[model samples]
Target: MQVAPRRTGEWWISPAIPAVANAALASLWAFTAFGGWGEQAFCGVDSAHDPTCATGFENAVLSSLAVVIPAVVIMVSALVLRRVRHYPDRLGMMLTAAAFLWVGAEGIVFLGGYLAQPS
Candidate 1:
């Protein structure tokens, strides 16, 4: 008979669930965020003719800020909370930090694309 591992006291919940869910969400965001999907969706294919459409520069800046700011906040939170009383769910915290790092990477790529765009 196969034996199951003993359950630990504090962290009964598995970290993989949230980690996978977040990963999936991040991927969806990446798929939609790049290639001017937001602008196209909001202003249609001919965004230039749409008076309501924000400039590409504006969209890029806002997108960068949106991800980067949250990434900073999540990173800060993970570091700050890590110093407190020994946390049981270290794996969960690490996964959270990893997710934000992914976001930070996306933000960097977005910034690069933004800079490359013609004014």
Candidate 2:
């Protein structure tokens, strides 16, 4: 028995599509963070009436981690897709892309709301 050749299109489909999709998501994140959307306060009183307060140092560290963790996952997945030969990479790529977009959107919404709040 002989192994069949992988389709030419498969080479382009798995890695290329996800790369473009994730890049777009990254750009959106940049825009949200720096496009005069709002100042992102990682640690502060959520509201005047709130009984709890987040220490600035702790919030900053945790918030940074929240962003970093997903970013690391995205980067790792992209690297994996580049080297994977036998498995279909589409599912992993799509899932990572979705996560990228979701995180970006959450950041945008969080900052947008913060800016919208009345001073």
Candidate 3:
């Protein structure tokens, strides 16, 4: 009986990709949580007594986690697949690629929302 050789084309899905993705997501989450972008909007309201603007600002900042949480999950899954033995290489690569794209999309959406808001 002859054993088939494993494919080597999936070398790009290394452990570093997930690790870097995790870091990127963490940084974005921290940036939003700390009001890096939303602070301006929060403070731009002309009326100091109006509560609606403050609430909108709060919601915008909090809503960022909607993207961060799933990105974290995907990052963790990719990391786990990279570490575990006998995990399918193609599946791991696909997950990592998808996660990377998702994170990119999330970042774009976050930026768009921030830019689109009235100052």
Tens digits of per-residue lDDT, candidate 3, 48-104, equal 433554455456555655665666666566546645424645545645654565566
Q: Candidate 1: list runs displaced more than 4 Å.
A: 1-11, 47-66, 69-88, 94-119
Give the least accurate 10-residue stretch of model 2, judged by summed lDDT.
Answer: 49-58
Report the Cα lDDT for residue 58, model 1. Answer: 46
The clash count for each model shown is: 0, 0, 0
**What does candidate 2's lDDT look like per residue over 1-119, in tens digits?**
22334696443344445555666765655454445222334323435422122232233334545664576575666556645423545544554665565565556446544544445
- Candidate 2 Cα outliers beyond 4 Å, as residue runs: 1-13, 39-65, 80-91, 94-116
Using TM-score as the measure, name the better of candidate 2 and candidate 3. 3
Model 3 residue pairs with clashes = none
Give the alpha-carbon lDDT of every model.
0.54, 0.48, 0.54
lDDT of candidate model 3 versus the reference: 0.54
